[model samples]
Target: MSTMTRTPELHPAANLPTRVSLADTLSQTMTMAWRAMLKMRRNFEQFFDVTLQPLLFTAMFAVIFGGAVSGDVSSYLPILIPGLIAQTVMTACVATGVQLREDMDKGVFDRFRVLPISRIAPLAGPMVADTLRYAIAATLTFATGIAMGYRPGGGVVGLTGAIVLAVFTGWSLAWVFTWFGTVGKSAQIVQGYSLMVMFPLTFLSNAFVPASTLPDWLQTFVKLNPVSHVVSAVRSLANEGTITAEVGWSVLALAIVVAIFAPLSVRSFKRKI
Candidate 1:
């Protein structure tokens, strides 16, 4: 004889919460951003890239190549500072991917998936929090330059514009890295690939030397490099104190990057989970 049996539910559909509203989405994202900031404050060590690296690299590059590049550190400061700002901000963005991967690997984001929050918030909130990294890296680069007697002809207003632009550009690029973080197999792989992309973009551009100094073919690449445009914009604002066409080009590039990567990262994150 067969006995009738009652079985527990295969899924807890009844327990699922309703979709969150837009305001709730915004609120959750901000809360997650605050959470990320709190984690950063507690870990303090995570700030080394935004702080110590900028200071050390700024001095090291100025001392090592200043003489050869511009004939003296004082002369080089103008060229070096703006380029360093672009470079440092980009490097600091690598953390976005690394930390995202770390979270994904450790199952931290698993908890996020269960929450009745916007899917993108857990991904984007940390990115919003990463603006602090951009701010710190850029400010330290400029402060290091000023300490080394690199007085920007641009003065306060110009310096402020350049810093704002750098922060925006860095934040935009970080979206691309965030996409990488979502798709990557692990944190190390993401960072390795990110470094591979970053080093070429930073070093092959006009950041370290005048484009004309490079071979003709390489000069063409440097001229076309978006980073070159960013550096040029910063240099114009910081050194010449002018907001030129270069600034427009840089901003356009940043907008394009954000428009492309923000959606891609969100989609990739949803796929992963």
Candidate 2:
């Protein structure tokens, strides 16, 4: 009668699988992207750069530099629209680092680390959501150009190609800034450094002016600059409606940047969190 009852074993620690499956990773990344979109929705001001910059810069640059650069604003539209698309999208890319650093400072990423999800979800999610911002910037810049009498010789197909390329450029280049976020001490520092990197990359390229107009030395540098390739590709698409070598070069550059910085950012983020 008096028999000793064996108590069932209890394991106090339960954990998710060490490696998340590819499907799970994709799902989690999408969920995080949705979360980022919600944040953007709540903070409507986040749209300011994507919205206002295209409008202001399109009109102002066309007016101020149009006559000087290309004889009139009308002629300048073709050149300026594509270049502005590149510059505006790059500008939006900078915010990705600043916001990531801010989120880290606020302990948001710390919470993300505690969850049983793939490490890259948080990193890639916002960048994925930011494609919308890039699209908006590209579209608005094109719209402003058309409204100001700028017509793309490439027409609808070329315009669509340009927009797609611009969005890809923003998303890919954002990896560099995302790495900055993981390593930077504060949001301001990240922003300052990001701007330092961004200004030279954008302004030093053939964005607003023809590289042929610059000094030989400057032109060489501009030719070597990857942004120049992107600008050239956008122009070729939006002006000529043709896929050129520049487009291939730009795509290669974007791929190289992501291949380099994306892993670096993820590693750095893992360490910090």
Candidate 3:
């Protein structure tokens, strides 16, 4: 007599949870953030933009353009410092997308897909780790300014507020880059496109020069430029020690940016991985 052997079929879904709880999502995101920190630590060159650029640009811009733009280095500190803070932080935000595209290309994010975690965790983790970079860049920028004899009238409290706002802005803006990373064909493409978007936003604004100095048409654009509002808010916080209408506009712009790009990044990231 021959006995027929039966094999039970297994469904992969049986082993996976239908949905990740909020607590689990948070825990998993933190774990992924730790992983990103380790990667950043191994590649110390990642700190160059945040560390070296602040030192070099702050000093170089203050010396070269200082006299030409504001009459002297001392006179330019108030304008240059806050502008540099915004520029440097936005530059840091570009790296978020480039690195993400590189990771995706190297199949790192593919590995993340197998884990039973929230889809957004891997995306959010890198941004969370990037907050440190933003903080370092903002701090070094202020330090370099002070070293050049720039005294912020805002004192410690206002300085603290400015730093916090810059970090938040960088993190929020990073989502735009994150979305690009998910959709870009390659890392270089992501970087090139990100710079294209960033340059106009930074340079066309009131970052390096006064909007009043620009032509009437350009001044109109500068007033409309969101980066100009950010720079103005930062200056108010660091140089004037008072909240201005620019601060409210900046916060509103940041909220709208995050609301739009964050979900788009998550959706695209989910599809890609």
Instruction: Name the candidate that leads on TM-score.
Output: 2
**Per-residue C-alpha lDDT of model 1 across residues 1-273, encoded as one tens digit per residue:** 999899877667567767888898889889999999999999998889889988998999999999999899999989888888888888888889989999988888887766778987997788889888888888889999999999999999889888888999888999888888998999999999889888888998988888888999899899999999999999998887899999999999999999998899989998888
The collision pairs in model 3 are: none
Would you list the rank order by lDDT, best first? 3, 2, 1
Question: What C-alpha lDDT values do all the predictions have?
Answer: 0.89, 0.93, 0.93
Candidate 3 local lDDT, residue 146: 90
Off by over 4 Å in 2: 1-15
Kindly report which residue pairs in candidate 2 clash with one another: none
**In model 3, which range of ten residues has the least summed lDDT?**
108-117
Instruction: Write candidate 2's Cα lDDT for 1-273 as tens digits.
Output: 899999887654354577889999899889989999999999999999999999999989999999999999998888888888989998999999999999998889887765778999999999999999999999999999999998888989999999999999999999999999999999999999899999998899999999999999999999999999999999999998999999999999999999999999999999999
Q: What digit string (tens of lDDT, one per residue) describes model 3 on residues 95-173? A: 9999999989999888777777899899999899999999999999999899889999999988998999999999999
How does each model score on TM-score?
A: 0.92, 0.96, 0.95
Instruction: Pick the winner on lDDT between candidates 1 and 2.
Output: 2
So what's the TM-score on candidate 1? Answer: 0.92
